[model samples]
Target: MATSKSKTSLREDLTCAICFELFKEPVMLGCMHHFCRRCIVSYWKSVRSPVTCPQCRQEFPNKCCFQTNYLVANLVEKVRASSSPASVKYLEKELNDCLESQCSMKDAYISMIRKDKDKMEKIKKTGAELQGRVHNDFQALHHFLQVEEEAMIEELKREQEEMLQGLERHLEALQVAIRDVEKNINILRQTAGSTDQSVLVELPKLNSRPISIDI
Candidate 1:
């Protein structure tokens, strides 16, 4: 294969400065500048007075003072022949295939990125919903537990109050019983001093009274 530099140099050598294409009928000016015959003629006709080389800007005395370069023309013909229609069509097809493949790859990458972003969003949404449900459940549980604790404490207080009232009533009853016993003791002391037969009769009645206390 020819190097890129050599190919570029060869193309530049065969190309006309005016039309910037491969020379149709190559011509040389007095300034040693090359152009297509029609291109140079048209350039001179469009300009005023003396003709100038398009590349070097060199002036020529005669307007039609350009010679047909047979060697350059032959080279141009050979270059044109070498780059046939079949070769040009093959190169075009290759370029089109490469561009199509690159576009398809780019589209595939874009699709993958879009799908991943959608999946990530779905994951975040689901996670947030689950968190909300958990928080609500914990709040409900806390409320229920608080209610249960308060009810239990109230029940304990009620039971404690009832027990304390019962104890107080029992103490009052015991105090009344103690006072009655003391009154009986004083009556016996007086009766023992007197040698009365009536007091001895009442002693039997006092012995008949029940002594066992019921709670």
Candidate 2:
């Protein structure tokens, strides 16, 4: 295994500052800023006179002032080859971990779906029970209203019949009084026409009785 510091150092040495790639046909300048041979040649060709390093800008005599860094090139190739095996092993482990995570999530999703289904069933059952209770309550209320209405109607009828009976008794008493008055008028007319003196002197007696209402 490589320590983090060593890995960082190796990565810095293996990479080229000019093209920012892994060194290809590497070369070194007097400034010690390593670059690819072709990259440095192309960069220096852009400027006239003494060429400067792309990294530190240390002036060189001209474009033809660099030497191949053979030791760095050999080290880069070895490090790249060795890190390849480690990269392959890490990728394999990562793939296996991703597969396990996916399976666990799938199971969780299934369990959540089942729980939601149960809750929905319970809710539906409760809704049905509530509906029945509402209907029953309204049915009882309607029955109570109907019974009260009938009882009230019966009471009204009884009161109306009693009032009618009292009125009939009053009418009968008035008829009897009217008849007696007419009879008395006939007797007075006969007395004025010189009927028997004794009969005229003895006037008819009148009797009246008030009707009674039982309420």
Candidate 3:
């Protein structure tokens, strides 16, 4: 018997069409193509409604096209686990690259969060300052209104007192005029009772002159 020639090729035995990464959850599509289930599912989610196979671009049934092949998935995991040190080193390099990229993403996320917090703090400070200004303005307006109201009340009191004094003066003058008229009527009544025609004649002249009281 002759020595066996190398028949298997590394390219055909271990490779993925898309992403070129070691398959994690390998799924066999109807078109005889292989891909990680999660990756293909994400690819299908980008499309509108109807789904299709990522490899051959062949249209698939709605919602139920993506299938999981546990056999292939287990085989890929076992092969990667049992790989040589050189193969593991290459995979480790890719994983380290991914870890570095994740570190950058983490930095970006942290920076964005810090910026958002700073913006929020600024907004809070501005709101507090504006509130203080509004409060001061309201207090000033209240003080002004209070002073004006007090002034108006004082003026009204003064005017009311003046009106009351004027009204009392008018009442006193009216009472004096009424008393004088009553006295004149009494004098006329007395003269009528007496048989004195002279006094009656003098009464007409007294009534024509203005009354004067010296008190």
Candidate 4:
């Protein structure tokens, strides 16, 4: 393979830069640049002196500065003879194989990119769904807490009202008992100087009456 590539490179080197073809009647300029003899002559006729090499642009004194390069001419002839129909077919097959491999690689890269894009879309969709579910879950939790709070507060209020009512009833009973005690003390003050036997009987009746209070 390396030998074949070297021969191909050598053949390319023997091609004329001006005509882009295998060198015919190859000639070398003073600058060592090569071209076909007729190609350089025609190129020089189109330009003014001092003439310049087509490839390097190196100036020459005159067209006479160019001379036939017999060695390059012989190399070009040998390269032409070596390029048989079979070799041309082999080169074509190699080019087609390279093109097919490049196309397959391109397809593989495109498939990978497509798969990655799909995965990205899936990730985004799943994330959005999860976020929605989280939001809904939190909202439900908040609602439950709110309901529990309201219920607890309402229960506390009812219990407090019941306790206050019980206390008020107890206070009213204590007030009535105090009024009865004051009435008995007034009676005792009025009857004390007389020293009546009937007052002693009334004292027993007053003692028998009871004031009942419930917590």
Candidate 5:
């Protein structure tokens, strides 16, 4: 009798139900089934009605039934490793490569973060300087207004003093004219003591001359 060769089955654990390929951006459905995110998205776009499970035939009222299944994907890899050591070793090598790439990405991200911090500090300092300048401008404007107000008050006071002085001068002139009239009346009274009553009455009818001054 001829010895039979044992058949090695390929891994169906990482295979996606939707695309029958390795699950990239794998997402879980409400029916607990795994599918690639792009694959499920494409299926959703093609469907006329609400999305449902292809395996269990469970119908969902809406197409928003898919979600990320990171834990399940990790579990699937673990299960595959228990069955096949070669697949596990291959997956570990790929995982190491991914880690190395991520390490480089982290270094770039750290440098970018440092740059952002420096930029943020510069912005904060500039903002503070702007605030100080704004405050100084307001203070300067306030002082200017105060000075203008005081100047206006001084001008008003000067005008009032000038008006009062003019009124005093006018009053003094009126007083002098009244005194001269009284003196003339006294002189007429004395002159009338030796004159007749008819001449005294005629003295009041005489025109008085106005006094004038240069200053």
Candidate 6:
């Protein structure tokens, strides 16, 4: 069984130099380089008296030998019939051969795996950086809320204290007025029990007196 490397080398060797295509009616020059019949003939007509090999540039006094390459032609036929059983067996042999050689599919697969691992590492690093940034942002936001909450609490306390002071002052004033009114009521009640005309007249004046209270 031929190796994949051998098959590739054979394919390269069978390719025509002038047309750079599959050898169509292949012919060999004096330098042993192969080219398509029409392609080489056309190239020679365009060049000067001495025709040269396109690959090696070796000049020949006259036109080089135009020998037919039946081996390359037959190989081309086998490669073209890829769906045939014979071609399939040949490809299988080449694949087996490539397994024994270096720089095969195994090495390529390992290289591909290494590349994906490196990519994953980069992705993980990026994810960590993003998470760290998000965490720091949340912490900053939480601290800001805490500061604002403290300031709000302080303002509430100050407002409540001011309200309490206002209420206390009003209550104190009301208490003092209650004590003064009670003292005057006791004095009037004693004066009314007297058998005097002046006492009765003063009682009517006390009833007419206007009372006021602080809001």
**Which candidate has the top score in TM-score?**
4
Candidate with the larger TM-score of 3 and 6: 3
Residues 36-138, candidate 3, lDDT per residue (tens digit)? 7777777777778566676677877774665788877776766666476987788779879999999999999999999999999999999999999999999
On lDDT, the stronger of 4 and 6 is 4
The per-model lDDT (C-alpha) reads 0.83, 0.83, 0.73, 0.88, 0.76, 0.78
Q: Which stretches of candidate 2 lie over 4 Å from their true place?
A: 1-83, 188-203, 212-215
For residue 171, give model 5's deviation from the true position in Å: 1.6
How good is model 5 by TM-score?
A: 0.46
lDDT winner:
4
lDDT of 5 by residue, 117-187 (tens): 99999999999999999999999999999999999999999999998997788778878788878888887
Going through the candidates in the order shown, the clash numbers are: 0, 0, 0, 0, 0, 0
**TM-score to native of every candidate shown:** 0.50, 0.52, 0.53, 0.55, 0.46, 0.47
What's the true lDDT of residue 125 in model 5? 100
For lDDT, candidate 5 versus 6, the one ahead is 6
For model 4, give the RMSD to the true fold: 8.7
Cα-based lDDT at residue 193, candidate 2 = 81
Clashing pairs in 3: none
Cα-lDDT of candidate 2: 0.83
Worst 10 residues of 3 by lDDT: 1-10
Evaluate residue 117 in candidate 3 and report its C-alpha lDDT on the 0 to 100 scale: 100
Candidates arranged by lDDT, highest first:
4, 1, 2, 6, 5, 3
- Clash list (residue pairs), candidate 4: none
Better of 1 and 2 by TM-score: 2
Could you give me the TM-score of model 4 versus the true structure? 0.55
